[model samples]
Target: MSKANAHVVWHPTTVTKADRQRQNGHKSCILWFTGLSGAGKSTLANAVDQQLHERGLKSYVLDGDNIRHGLNRGLGFSTADRKENIRRIAEVAKLFVDAGVIVLTAFISPFREDRELARGLVEPDEFVEIYVKCPLEECERRDPKGLYRKARSGEIAEFTGITSPYEEPLSPELIVESGTQSVEESVQIVLRYLEERGIIPARR
Candidate 1:
């Protein structure tokens, strides 16, 4: 190991994750929403967050565009940058899990390998991969940000589903049909899964 790295040591938190979970009355995990641009990942994630907030559950969403404006501002849309972006977000999500908060992350996360690495950062049950399934044509049709148009005009470089690639999840824990389902429907599906898995309590 490098001398600089050898000097760094791990420090445990005073309050444990279980302690926080017990006090919060819900288990902590990351709801990883992955899909192509304009596939409704951000919409679903925020909608679910609102539901959890209304239920007084400890939950938060780390959105792609919002996060890029802050934590990942300097990162660009390149293969290596995308990989690093996912890595940094995964580490942040791990910290959230340790704090016993149900965190939701909505990102394109185009590479399966990078998503797998993110999943590996937490426990088996802690990583809930939700694939927002929508066809390329549908995504282009619903291009809310005009990203598809820009990408097609060569104004954007290495954009997923355009110049770049998006590797779909082989077996996600849940698949939300974003093209056909309304935002409310998609939110319920995610919330139902959390309740079924005992991560969050069922509606009383």
Candidate 2:
């Protein structure tokens, strides 16, 4: 171990994750939402979080732009920076899972290696990859933040799905067709999956 690591030791929490899950009446997991820009990842993640909250379930959303303004403010859009950003978010999500909170992260990520790295941090069933599938043409047309326009006009560098590439998840836990489906329909798809997986109780 490195000198810095040798002194650091693992500390166990007195109140275990299972204890918190029992109290919260739901399982804790990470709902990782990956897609290109303008793919509605943040919108869907927030919608899911709201639904979980209304159901008295512990849940929170870690959005890309919001997080960039704070925890990852110093990072840029470079390839290395993007990887680091996802790494940090993954670590934070794992902590939330340990605290028995269902954490949803909305990010482009754009790399299979990075996504798999995030998955490896938790148990097999603890991480759910939700691919927000939308065509490049649709995303550019939508351009909610005008990012695609900027990228197309050469105002931005190394942007995913324009200058850089967005690697789609090969076999995601769920695939939300954001391009074709209504927002409410997409939200229901996610909720149904959670219920079927025993992460949340089914509605009466």
Candidate 3:
């Protein structure tokens, strides 16, 4: 370590705390949902968001397809692009958290390093990782978007669980078994976890 390499810098900004609080009206956090495609990650995330909304909590969802259409439109399914995509989304999620809005992100992600990097970008309690666990066969059977079929049929390349790989989380904050559990059960589990953590008030 060399002090000569370090430089002090300051950037001026004028945004008051009250202003941000009034704009979002709730504490901000990042709920990172990871799993195989067709594992019900998006479904569970959206359902949890709906429950939070009913409780007057402010939240937004960052989904895979939705982001690819905009912020990550230029990115592809390559390993490098996938990492970059998660990096960009993580940065955006950090911004949303600072703005006091709960951000629910649903992505395969498929790499522990990228997920860890995303977690490192935010404060300790601000990031929550939910593992939507589902067997490969079950995911293929569900095929919510027909991606599994396409990947198997060569219509898609380097798809996770097909030509590529999906690295499961070693230790996730929460686990939702989409294959064996009902959607409502999964939603309730997530809601309970959030409530226990005081992210949201206990349901009435």
Give the per-residue lDDT of model 1 (tens digit) for 1-204: 444565669554468999999999999999999999999998899999999999999998998656888888899867788888999999999999999999999999989999999999999999999999999999999899999999999999778999888999999999999989988999999999999999999999
Q: How many backbone clashes does candidate 3 have?
A: 0
- What TM-scores do the predictions have? 0.92, 0.92, 0.88
- lDDT (Cα, tens digit) per residue for candidate 3, span 24-136: 55557899999999999898889988988888888889997679899999898777888899999999999888777888999998999999999999989889999999999
Residues 18-70 of candidate 2: C-alpha lDDT, one tens digit per residue: 99999999999999999999999999999999999999999999996568898
Top lDDT model: 2
What is the descending lDDT order? 2, 1, 3
Q: What residue runs in model 2 are displaced by over 4 Å at the alpha carbon? A: 1-13
- Candidate 3: where are CA atoms >4 Å away? 1-13, 16-26
lDDT of each: 0.92, 0.93, 0.88
RMSD of each: 4.6, 4.4, 5.3
Tell me the deviation in Å of residue 119 in model 1. Answer: 0.2
What TM-score number comes out for model 3?
A: 0.88
Specify the poorest-scoring 10-residue window by lDDT in model 2: 3-12
Candidate 2 to truth, TM:
0.92
